[model samples]
Target: MDSIFHEKQEGSLCAQHCLNNLLQGEYFTPVDLSSIAQQLDEEERIRMAEGGVGSEEYRTFLQQPSGNMDDSGFFSIQVISNALRVWGLELILFNKTKLSDGSGGFLH
Candidate 1:
């Protein structure tokens, strides 16, 4: 499928934009950012906060694999994976790492 591009807001709306792009079509209604943000729990919101990663709460959130739909500022791999799974799709992540040596090999 061709993706529709959307520039995200300053903060806390990347996932909403992603969802809008993913669901923009006749059969799917767009999701609202505020609605999604409202669904987040206190802990998730804290995790989403700027510089929250240094906090113990964010550390705890990272340790757990549950509650994928909590609007934690940015969407993690697990969140996207769970969202795709709900739509009967699988999420595949790809990365390329460049070699530090003089050789031009890339690791995938």
Candidate 2:
């Protein structure tokens, strides 16, 4: 059941809804989610082309990714966002690095 839910998440159907609802602006997009859900996705292409964030050994550990970026064997956005939406709250802290002007004014 968890796996199925995760699979749906990886497909990003939930993210689409979120975008339509809670997504304000800037970060997150349905296009971004869909790309990873399908094989030959742009993210995988970019990763391979750019020698992405992980080590070769880690890639090797994942059974070589089957050269298929679209397969959601474990993790995905649907699973992640669903979990987040169901039991999540946004947390942002006040920026402590405000600048102090010479006139005792602080800038955030």
Candidate 3:
């Protein structure tokens, strides 16, 4: 999908940006960081201090009962994959690691 990169606001809004990128051309309404934070659980809310959300916090939000993982304050590979799955979109993960021989290998 063609999407414009959104710069995060004062709070944790990485997830919002990711969602915008994923659904920019889709039929979903655009959402802001505050709105996303409002949906976060208590624990996830705490993680939204200053630096915004991290990978762990994003992951936790994805597993919430609401299943609105795209409304998290941050985004990670796992979070993005989960959000895409909710919309029937498939995501492929590629991991590149450097070997002892100074060569790169694709993991899995």
Candidate 4:
């Protein structure tokens, strides 16, 4: 590898920084990730609607905040996975892979 690229941590946007640093450039911003999160939220809502929008469960889901992201800038793994998919990259689950170094990070 060449010189390491590190995006200084700002606020609670670790996912955004991680993605940019991992890609070795400022390829993603908070807005970009948030947009992806919103899309995921909509997809989830649609899936829940498939179970009947009039159902209590669906109503409850609609009333709840998005699972993909929150106001504090936190993002779910699904968001990260989707962001990486844009670059043709994949994130392998830690438990599903053998970690030779025991380091915590996406294997792929």
Model 2 CA deviation exceeding 4 Å by range? 1-12, 23-32, 36-108
- Of the pair 2 and 3, which is ahead by TM-score? 3
Question: Tens digit of lDDT per residue, candidate 3, span 21-73?
Answer: 55764322234333333444444546544345566766665556543334444
Q: Which candidate is the best by lDDT?
A: 4
Q: Global lDDT for candidate 2?
A: 0.43
lDDT of each: 0.52, 0.43, 0.50, 0.91
Q: Where does model 1 exceed 4 Å of error?
A: 1-10, 25-72, 98-108
Deviating ranges (above 4 Å) for candidate 4: 96-108
Residue pairs clashing in model 2 are: 9-78, 9-79
Give one digit per residue, the lDDT tens place, for model 4 in 1-108: 779989999999999999999999999998999999999999999999999999999999999988899988899999999999999998887665656766554565
The estimated TM-scores of all candidates read 0.39, 0.25, 0.36, 0.85
Name the lDDT value of residue 97 in candidate 1: 53
Arranged by lDDT, best first? 4, 1, 3, 2
Backbone collision count in every prediction?
Answer: 0, 2, 0, 0
RMSDs, each prediction? 9.4, 12.5, 10.9, 4.7
* Best-matching candidate per TM-score: 4
